[model samples]
Target: MWLDPFLSELQAGDGLPVLDLGCGAGNNALYLTERGVPVVACDLSEEALKLVSERVPEVRTLVLNLLEPLPFGDGTAPAIVADLSLHYFHWADTERIVAELRRVLKPGGLLLCRVNSIRDTEYGAGQGTELEPGLYESGGRIKRFFERDQTEALFANWTIEALEENVLLRYEKPKRAWMVAARRDWA
Candidate 1:
């Protein structure tokens, strides 16, 4: 998982923040906090923030909608974890969010994420209405699935340390996802 790479690169008193964008239910937040990494966990749900606080009292939790600009100082984040949270956006919104992420992260900082892949037919890959080239609308929710080329194109200027597609089970259903580890190369 990302914990090995993230924890290995961080210590308890590191000044740089480890951002947990869209930290739903505090799964990753608890993991990082338990391992002694200082984390700032943000989510759109107040209930989720409550859960994080209850689960890990030391975590810095906030209610944040990722579609807007992140509420952090520029070049302050040293590492970010965005598990299954980078989807669900139109092209422009996705670009804006990525731009904010790049702006907040320090040079050589990491953005590790898992995103929906186009191959995920077992979940609604081909069933949804195609909104854009890689975007779809299902059950009133919009999600963007990425191919390898799409992933490469989205973060074209970043140092893509790793990008691989795989099928795994989540919440008892098979999920087609892409694991991405990309770094900001310049300040």
Candidate 2:
């Protein structure tokens, strides 16, 4: 998994449970729990959370909607894993959600995430009606792809520890995405 390099930093949260935002099927949550890290797996789908609960009974599960404000307190979460969940929104909504994520994280906390890249042609990069520069709508679903500069602009307020475009082969076809490791440096 891409999270291997950051395990130590992720575990440095003083035993606070990590929030796995948009945790579909709890893949990352399971990985973290298997390594002895406490995790709270959150998703919008109750079925997904149920599957996660069945697979890892020790993991705490919550139903979350990204469009609304997060239920966490300010500077509470030590680490958050967004995975491939931050791309399904309009530009403004995306910004708002990211700001909320930052607000819920402790100073120096990490926000690890992956998002669809502008070059991800195999996964509907330019397949639908363009809502904005990188935002699109197809089959009633909205997706936002990020260019390098766009991703940088999105996280301009935070200290980006790592940012790279990489192809993931976990799926049947190659999936291109931007892997980001950003830190909330201020409270």
Top of the candidates by TM-score: 2
Q: Per-residue lDDT for 107-130 in model 1, tens only?
A: 888888888899987766766799
Off by over 4 Å in 1: none
What are the Cα lDDT values of the candidates?
0.84, 0.94
Runs of candidate 2 exceeding 4 Å displacement: none
True-structure Cα RMSD, model 1: 1.6
The per-residue C-alpha lDDT of model 1 at residue 82 equals: 90
Candidate 1 positional error at 70, Å: 1.1
In angstroms, the error of model 1 at 97 is: 0.6
TM-score of each: 0.93, 0.98
Worst 10 residues of 1 by lDDT: 5-14
